[model samples]
Target: MAGNSDPLTPRAKLAVTAGKAVAAASRAAGRGSGSVIGGRVALKLDPDLLARLAQNLDCVLVSATNGKTTTTRLIAEALRAAGPVVSNALGANMPAGITSALAGGSDAKFGVIEVDEKYLAGVARDTDPKCIALLNLSRDQLDRAAETRMLAENWREGLAGSKAVVVANADDPLVVWAASSSPNVIWVAAGQMWKDDAWSCPSCGGVMQRPGDDWFCGECGFRRPTPSWALSGDHVLDPHGSAWPIHLQLPGRANKANAASSAAVAAVFGVPPQVALERMYQVQAVAGRYDVVQFEGRDLRLLLAKNPAGWLETFSLIDPPPTPVILSVNARSADGTDTSWLWDVDYTRLTGHPICVVGDRKLDLAVRLEVANQHFQVCENLDQAVQLCPPGRIEVIANYTAFQDLRRRVGN
Candidate 1:
């Protein structure tokens, strides 16, 4: 439909008719687009339909439980520095979205996409990518996905039967163990790790390494080697909300983790560190991850939390010292049919003493905070929460539905 406006077309009308017909039939078959998938034709097409589009593809696929969107976008930019690239640089990481990206860029030499854990195997099978960057897998979306170990096993299967080279985070026990025996695997070290202690031994299911970030198995003696790229240093945010030279497109160490993961994948595409750093300067933050705003002369930082693991990371980023906050949550089946994961996050990080809570499930957020011995102010609606903010300082945290509610309020 988009290309139909082109001139000098004799059979173009016929081609447009076919495209429209194909798109219409898909909707009738319960495979329509525009909610998660867009433009009925772009997504409803099958593997063979996309198979025809995959030619001369030099792909870099990023898969993980977290940080995929930011890292995928970063790797795409760094790959562009190396040569021509085709990427789903947006946050669209599903199978249909990936197919749409490939169809849109059949001429590109490389394709980079962020993939979900449940879909990694299918995506790898369908796309047959050149390199697959697996970020650390953590517990997330237990309702929609399998257990963390199950996802890792699927990734292991993908790795075993793949032509793609693997670049993985060395600090993570799951990723490090997988990389050790793989003939075509590269280890990318974490610049820093907030979590110093590791859990069960990778070898004998006994207690693993303790003391600092160095990982070692007490049972079978399998250990982590020094990383190729070590964390140089980190800057801490002061009590006054001022931090030192933390120059990144996004906020939080979690994002720095994203930057590091992207830089590692960029290496697979042959992008030099200096060039990657330069591209980093040009890169902008992904819209939903700590997307900032200036409201009533205060800063509004919006973070999308999907699970307990990410919720912990969000807490770590917002460490101590009374800062104004407005947190929101929702219960749409898409955002986990159950909000039970809220019980696991250590939410005391909202140091402002009394965070403003808003949403249909505002009580859920408030109750979670109160149970954790934190304070909060509940509002019936988002606008009331927005109005409750003093004319000075503020920050907003929103989940799927709450995000839409805020957008309606402030046009964000």
Candidate 2:
């Protein structure tokens, strides 16, 4: 039964039961997690199953090119302080997976959903969330997803009349334009590390003029909004200007930025910044990201970086000099078929590390590293790469599918 609504109709209830059965069967067969397939079956039976499941919960949607999964986890944890919260803890952000998540947690009071960028508008329409968090947007899965500006336009069109309170990043011009149509917005100055995709204004198509932490269009004046919440060096400033130190087990400034965004979104659900931060601090790892597992007697820290923007943040989280770093790349369907995005990453920053490369697309990554004048050794597999590393902590950074491959092998 839904937490705040009437009982599900007979059709929807049957759909939910069948979906759960399929999901369980999938897990038993080890085919996959079955979140997507199960939800697909359910939706096929009852097209409105997602909306039906979401009807009784105060849903919150988190969507972005990067950090959506981690941010979703953070917000879910923070919301738990208020009551039971349901979330797709795995990296399933599509409609089917989201439906599965909601159907599975029907009794929960809150739904924290991680939505794929392209699917955000549809999911938002179906869920009618109380709050939506638009994190940074950058070039990711270019072969499969739309360009940043097109996505921004889609968001602008889809969410034009949404009654949800949008918690958006003020630093990114693209996000600013996308959320510009919303009547209720809480802008957070979460820093944007990759600015290449947002140089052109989404409104006027003019070159954006960025001056020392602020951005504005030169031709049509589409500017960055004044954020009520801001992320400083190592702290997050609330709307009242009180700075809260972001102490997290998660690595890098990106996670700090994610924390700031999560805090702001949590506040919409009546969770105070102090309480939210306290709950979020308990999340050490999000879906194998930043998880350190033992592989052949050495500690292997797994970091997932699918695109250039993600790689930038992952590089910052690497252990300093001489720690053996394993760079993995894949061009599977999950990872974009094109590996050209490798050139956009700064591999030169990894100069001081003992770098070992592996994955389906290692040669492509090798060429990028060579162009940057960085030395690396090519290994056939993760095990072979780990064998080459000296004893102690070994950092493994991989793209989408490659990371999952290693995670399964290492039993994370």
Candidate 3:
């Protein structure tokens, strides 16, 4: 057993010990990843394990419907220029996962957390982060997250009293509205490609005016906030109008936007702009999002898309007619039980591309593709689907459980 070097109270130490034991037992039984169960046991024993472990450490919370995992990973990497930083690298965002991270990283000088959308406020309140990065918010897991408007309102109410600086996406109307009440804010012009969830103004329920990339409410005069940090191609424009070049191993404009937000958060901790950008370039993959895995004699690049917004972003990262792509979907609990969001994704974009559908919900996806007149083959077995895909590297886009299954299959 690794010695508990954290300066935890006697009760907290006991709780952490119990949690680690449960985690080890779980792994031994091949139950699963055990990250969540371990944290759950610890929290069950000490209810305030997160708060206790977070003491005396600089913490940053990254919350968004789509980019939470990737953004959190980027921020943690950037913070490495300072010293060792602790983060939940397993894509765990709930209280249990967070407790595990804090307890495990108890001796680390800094913390970066990817918080689930609905649980952001509660976690932020407990951790009392030094900075909170608010990325775009859209309708995700509708069965779990009731309404997008309510979530934004909850953020506004929760962050109104916090003294922490908020690094927010100015292009997202929901984010702009949510961060409006924060005492200290640094808005970044991170582009927004998903706007279906924000057609109306949250303040007046009136139609919003979109002239260019900016938005404004005609009735209540609510508008987009000007950003101090902006992205121009791969270069980041700081508040002083100085451009810092950024290069990332991860592909996609979405990741570039993530880099901009992370750089801004790193600045609050005194990390140089170039140093932050250089460190961000080191992140090749987040969880299994961009992992190139070898499975059954085939090389597949895995991409995760759990909702319409995520699908749009993932699709943008791929070439219009790149290697054959596999689209996988599942209605498991991890993926919301509802599969209606499939219709919300613009399948028309893949009109000329070959798509192989796989997953428990392949039939659901097949129907949607047929409706869009997209030619696709449904292969229930992913290995079989890979066999059908074109030679050379192929792209595999999977949602929640399907993505996780593929990662495990490749021994990731």
Q: Is candidate 1 or candidate 3 better by TM-score?
A: 3
- For every model in order, what is the number of clashing pairs? 2, 0, 0
**Candidates ranked by lDDT:** 2, 3, 1
Off by over 4 Å in 2: 1-3
The candidate, 1 or 2, that scores higher on lDDT is 2
Best-fitting candidate, measured by lDDT? 2
Provide the global lDDT of candidate 2 against the true structure: 0.92
Q: Please identify model 1 stretches exceeding 4 Å from their true place.
A: 1-45, 191-198, 202-204, 234-246, 295-298
List, residue by residue over 64-130, the lDDT tens digit for candidate 2: 9999999999999999999999999997899999999988885699999999999999999999999
> Residue 284 lDDT in model 3?
90
Cα RMSD, each candidate: 6.7, 1.2, 2.5
**Candidate 3 colliding pairs:** none
Evaluate model 3: give its TM-score.
0.97
Model 3 stretches astray by more than 4 angstroms: 1-7
